[model samples]
Target: MGAATPSAQGPRILGSRGSGSSPATGPEAPGSPLTASPGGRMGLPGAEILVGLVAGIDVNMPCLGFALVAKDLEAARDVLRVCERLGIELSEPFYTRKGLCVTAVVELPWYENPVHFLRRRVEGYLRYMLPDVRRVRRVWGRLVWKRVRLPAAEADVLMPLVERLLREYGMPGLKLPATVAEDLEELVYEWGRRWRRSYDWAFKVATGRIFRAVSRLSRRHVVLVKLEDLRGIKRKEKWVPVIRRWPWTRLLRLTLGCTPPWVGVALVNPRGTSSDCPACGGELKEHSYRELVCESCGRKWHRDAAGAANVAFAKPVEYLRFPASSPMNPKKPGGGEDGGNEETQRTSRLVDKDPQPRAPRDGSRPVAGVEHTRQRGPIEGLTLTRPQTLPPGFPASKG
Candidate 1:
């Protein structure tokens, strides 16, 4: 009876903060991780859904947004719709002016983890880099006025130690998360001009971190990023949302591509993501398909995909690995429904099981680990690219 009481009260006790020291947690620590990988995704009728959604962020800020493309048209549309809806919900807080004061937690439903990451990011390694560069500039730029660019060399020397300290000096067994990868990628934008090597190193580090993050999740991750501008959007509205102008998907892909061949990394088509309502099969007629209006049900939803389309299903696979007790993932090593191990392995290796390098190189920069430099994929269903070499101490990405 006594033991049961303590056990019963255990949850409450822990919740009360009277326990021993706990790991530091940010605003997103308590939300479900299901919102990040496949669990956060929506399903299309038949085609394989890539980036089923693209959500805009911070309406108050300059219109920087994200896109989800799967390289496949039908699949991309499904992903885009979800992203569009999420973008509106998130932007609402800012629109109502509530987000300015941290009045409510609006991001927990879909992208909780990313929201938390943005909060924790203010104190990352990036903060230290620029100030150091500035201090050096304050003294150096004055000493040599336009004779030669010496700050680059000086920055190289002063920066590496700080970078090393950040990566190595942390407590043993503490692993950085994918959010830090975003921070590292952002560092490139801030410092890339002054220190090119540092930017490269930061990008390399971010890719490695993201590779590990994408790997641990289920193998069916289809990385949907904005690829190309299919057509110019004709907006009739007096004012367009700021995010419509942002290329959120592009930044995500370029950063992850620094390492190459990450599983689930691909460009998803942005058409039809949010044109027709997933709830109702009605054509959306409002704000260039930005806002989805289901005339049949009258339930309106904000659309996010760049364009429109239809879909169909493919065969399922065998030998699937599901969660330990998840209903879908059987504990037993059951055979796949259609093709057996060979076919399953091939598809899984490209996504859920393998690393998808970002879409094929445009022949501008050389892709590392690509044996035969013949580049003709991305459009014709090539998801896995060559893996790049990782620096020492960086974990090798799983195939």
Candidate 2:
């Protein structure tokens, strides 16, 4: 995290729900055309460029919260202002010293105490198997009781074969019963089926949320994920079962598998992602069950959103570096002994825009990205406008 302070202007509450019109209900519709190509465009010769926004994702049990922050500080802030003015998906965008951070939380319908659900399923299997096992044991015991009634020599011969059969096919430790192997197989199948259903459902929901977020924003180049390793955490014996069953690693795999080849996914450390404020690097105090407030700046934040924004701004601990000239990179490497690429020089640049839309010689004006012919709905009067360009000599600190 960077060392910075909150704006002296105080928290402006960029997208808070209010007593007036909904913050999502803007005068103009927030929809804008995504004009850049997926992955990125080729940069100037020998210049390494990050052609799109960096996406940071915070994966939690209740929801997957994500925030998009541009590599260029100024562009990120501008994007925040634009999205707020347009009211995109009723999302919350917060202004931070790093840049304008836009966040969205996708709710999940996954089972709480998922371990309990699996245990209940196992109990159901036991219920069905108990009667079968008891019946087989009783029948075997009755046969043994009749052995004494038979002629001595005949009983000896018959008892040996029956006992051998029981040893071969039954659970011998408790005077084994028949069909136990088949019963065990059925129990395992049931457990697997139940677990697989829950796992698949969660991944599906997460994939949909990721795609939806990407579609709404402009082009994105990289996704930073907070790596949550729950294995080493201490827990009670009862909780040990729950922690072992956690699907965080599988969810991380889903994030990796579902993204486009051009999108670089990296893992960042999870420590303090939610505890620290996104606006300032101050500790956050619990404000509510699901909210936290910065102790230093007094900024309130949703627990998950704050974590996601932190992931967006935090440095990645693990990432696959692409060759500067690769399609995924779209930049040329400079001739240097260290294989250094000049891409960092271009990191502060925004996605190139087409020359501002001009009116036709027919003497009529047209909105840049707005479609006037579309039927008016909730965003009927909304028009999309680009943010004003900053002066060349504008202080980088203010940006």
Candidate 3:
């Protein structure tokens, strides 16, 4: 795999928090009627746009966490309406492959702690999605090519030559003529820089406990959903993160900015749930963590894709629980938490316990050894093995 090139680099900004000014005030203020309502800011302007959905995927080494945010009731309804028309059942867990989609996957490196690893993974995912060289080229080419139709042979030749020139000279990659390159490069650079900063700020805000708590406080009516809850829809769930971070709504506004005759919904994994025989809800047996395997029906699914379909059809109310219950919460009132006595909470978070027993360095008999006889260890009979079946739609190469 290629090392991910730094799309754009600059000092990270953690949003308006440090500025002491609320994020609700700036010209591009998040809570503004014109700006998108992130984290459920109140009194959001009616979504004049037909469908606005925000999906977030928390990428993890083992499983991806995903959530969807629809700005208005109409947008959510539209999604449901489409599912109904397509003959997809929302109540049942299933995948829907529809539309241009993006997802995030939280990655846990072998050495890093889960929380830190997840934080970094989220930051990286957001940066990857922002405006970058590759995205610019792809979008630019499409726009330029659409207006001027040339003979197939001539058009192909010109495009390649232009690309080569840009590469050889270390010139900024733009489809326009050399005369316009200077201006376009500056614009591209500024746009990329701003977006990179915005992404960094947004990421910090999203992952922090403070932000999450504040979000809950601000939007009392909002229901937070997690990808794990949608596991029944798809057999595997790796790409749920990608689906969540995809800026579909932003892309819509950017691309179709004031156009009246624009209408489309892109689905990435369409065959996810519909093609499966609904009679066999037995397909559910396949869902373990992120893999969807139905032994009874002999059907398999990529967990993420299946979940995405289910997400498209499922009502927000059905999967409204948190992804992880807080382990820090006190089970007993007198005990502070973590099963420790009240004193433990006042002193420090650590729990005191008897020293762990050490294991014998080498196998030895209880007496003199002819051949080594092993004693029953704490985990003597238990074996740790890799998961037997891969989640559906997981690329074999990923394994």
The most accurate candidate by lDDT is 2
lDDT of each: 0.32, 0.51, 0.35
Please list all clashing residue pairs in model 2, or write none if there are none: 28-382, 29-382, 30-86, 48-343, 171-176
Cα lDDT of model 3 by residue, 147-216, tens digit: 1122221233334544554465443543443324344334434544554455444444323322232132
lDDT of 3: 0.35
| Tens digit per residue, CA lDDT, model 1, 19-48 | 333343531134422111122121121212
Q: What's the lDDT for residue 391 in model 3?
A: 98
Error of 2 at 316 (Å): 1.7
Against the true structure, what is each candidate's TM-score?
0.24, 0.48, 0.22
lDDT of 1 at 144: 25
Worst 10 residues of 3 by lDDT: 258-267
Q: Please give, for residues 285-339, the per-residue lDDT of candidate 2 as tens digits.
A: 9979788889898988878778888887775544432211222232334422222
Candidate 3 ranges beyond 4 A from true positions: 1-179, 203-327, 332-334, 337-344, 347-399
